[model samples]
Target: MVFKDKGRVMDGFYVTGHPSVPVYVLKSGVIFDGGFTALARHYERDIRDILGNTSPEYIFITHSHFDHVGSISYFKSVWPDIKVFGSVNAKKILSRNGAIELIQRLNNISRAHLLSYGVNDLYEGEFEPFLPDEVVEDGSVIRVKDGLEIHSRYTPGHTRDFMSYWIPEKRILIASEAAGCDDGSGYIISEFLVDYDEYINGIKRFMEMDVEVLCVGHRYVITGDDVRSYLLSSLQHAKDFVEMVINILNEENGDIDKTVNRVKAYEWDPRPFPKQPEMAYLLNTQARVKLIASKYMKN
Candidate 1:
């Protein structure tokens, strides 16, 4: 089953924020990702209402992307003692001035975009930069409480700092972008921006896990038999998408710009509302095309 609404996925897991940029909160006081600042602000009341007296203790960052970490500073302001966790590379990325500025800019764009779509109840707070309280390497286990333990798995490629959290006892995997995103269009958009091979490997690793519930980075929370089905299909889609990009690059005479434009027109341009912003989409598509070109194109 795929859940696209903002509500409780089960007893303790709740999905808040716009479907375009959803945030996951666990009753164990752990958040999967921060999501966009504006959307986070819009859903603050809902998230707080869901949490009630359970103050969030930790935030597990999947990556250092603008959308992913946009609300960390806001979250910190709410829960001053909440410790943020991310990969070592994410810590570095979030600390850089240029990256922070870019994140703020993208967040503003998202804010305007949401307002244009009639979502005007967003809080007026700005995006703030923050560093992770602790960096978790691959295989690191975070003991959230007596029965819940979150195992961090380093799953890169969408970004070098990407990390996915796994809860063995609950059979849940908070795989933000590591398993790609299902835009509810019956397609898994392959987001291997940094390294295609690493992305593919990450999906394969996820396929080997015992997951009953799969929470992706955006749009959908999959459960039951669909978890493995989604993993298998995501792996296949990544492979096929990379191969398609390679073919396009070759046909375009190994021109990265042309290939990116071509792929964007074909895959991204026709997407409906609540899709990725144009600038972010073009940037990520360029990176993916460049990676494919560098790896597969003949000299």
Candidate 2:
């Protein structure tokens, strides 16, 4: 069943949350970053039904993280002819046998957690290695259809391989983890797993763009005034976190655990997820503290 191409609408088609699948759909097909086939297991059919007869032409990965590229195998199985695009670093990471195995192993960890929550319609095909057809870098224009073009920009800092996309004419910017992950409501989690400077710089880079529609990496979109609101919050949060981590480290004499704990209590704008478990918050807090320490508090 093939879906007919429709005219470009202001908001073509966007979906998010529940199972946490975020994709930016265009007229040609749909564009997405990370995917968890296991999470989307129960909703894949509904997702397909929503898109009707439209087929994917490409799946542009934002980074090489296990969660980001987890469903490549499943997507490949569904759309064999779809081209995969990502940064050169992402290409190298996906090309490795070791990395592929590690991704599958991590995916299993995610799947087991999903089942605990009662989601079990997942396909058992993620333990396979899948490579991209196109290796793009900063400033690469990928033509999805006759007139639609997605310009790739290498926005490292989320991981060295992180890439974001910009559709010039539409004023839409698909910022990868370079910005921050929005937890549905309004809370944003600033996870700079690498360097704090890089993460902040990446956000600043996108801030220069005239974005009307902002697509975040996690599972949310910001439009109108919220687009600016999210970016401003992202910038301020990163700065605040870095400063707090540094001050805590200085006072605690570089005690990472103490710093992480302090950061854990820091209030996010609006608030963190209402149902966020302590363990999850602790883990992300630890990551934020560690990265901040490595980038700022180092001796």
Candidate 3:
């Protein structure tokens, strides 16, 4: 079952903001991702209502992408004591001025896109870049409470800093982009921005886990038998996407630019609204194509 509603989907899990860039919150006062600034502000009341009196104490960042961390500053302003956690590489990325600027720019573009879609309650502000308070390496376990523990897995590929959190007690895995995204189109989008091999390995690792609830990065919260089904399909999709890219690269005689354009025209241009921004899409596509061309086309 796919959940896209903006409320409590299960006992302790809540989804807020736009489904395209939804934020996940636990009743125990932990937020999975920051989401967009405007959307976060618009859904602030809903988030607070779900949290009740328990002020959010921690935010676990999946990666350092613009949309994934768009509302960190807003959350910090609301809960000044909230500590943010991410991988060590994420800390390095967020500290760079160029990265922050690009994030802000992409956020501005995203807000405008939202407005065009008739979303009028977006928060007005530039994206703020804040470093994580703690860096979690692979296999680090955070005790959320006496009985609840959030285990961090360093699953890179969507980004080198990507991390997936799993709660064994609840049988929930916050896979983020590590397990691909639904995008409301019933199609899983493989997001291997940095390394395709690592992305596939990350998916394989998730497949080995016993998951009941799977929280993707965007637009879908899968549950029950679908969890294993989704992970298996996601793994296949990631491999198929790479194969398609390699075929296109070969067709283009290993020309990265041409392959990127062809892939964009075939895969991205047909996607409807509530999708990734064109600039972001192009950048990620270029990275994927370049990686494939260099890694697979090396005679």
Query: What TM-score does each of the candidates earn?
Result: 0.97, 0.82, 0.97
Model 3, 135-177: lDDT tens digits are 9999999988547888999999889999999989888899999
Which window of ten consecutive residues has the lowest lDDT sum in model 2? Answer: 1-10
Candidate 3 accuracy as TM-score: 0.97
Q: Model 1 — TM-score against the truth? A: 0.97
For residues 24-63, could you state the per-residue lDDT of candidate 1 as single tens digits? 8888888888899987665577678887866789899999
Off by over 4 Å in 2: 1-10, 16-19, 40-43, 261-287
- After superposition, candidate 1 runs with Cα above 4 Å error: none
| Candidates by TM-score, descending order | 1, 3, 2
What count of clashes does model 3 give?
1
Cα RMSDs, all models: 1.2, 5.1, 1.2
For residues 117-228, write the lDDT of model 2, one tens digit per residue. 6765766656567777888889999877647788898777767788888988778788857888766545567767766777888888888888887767555566667777
Considering only N, C-alpha and C atoms within 3 Å, which residue pairs clash in candidate 2?
Answer: 3-53, 34-68
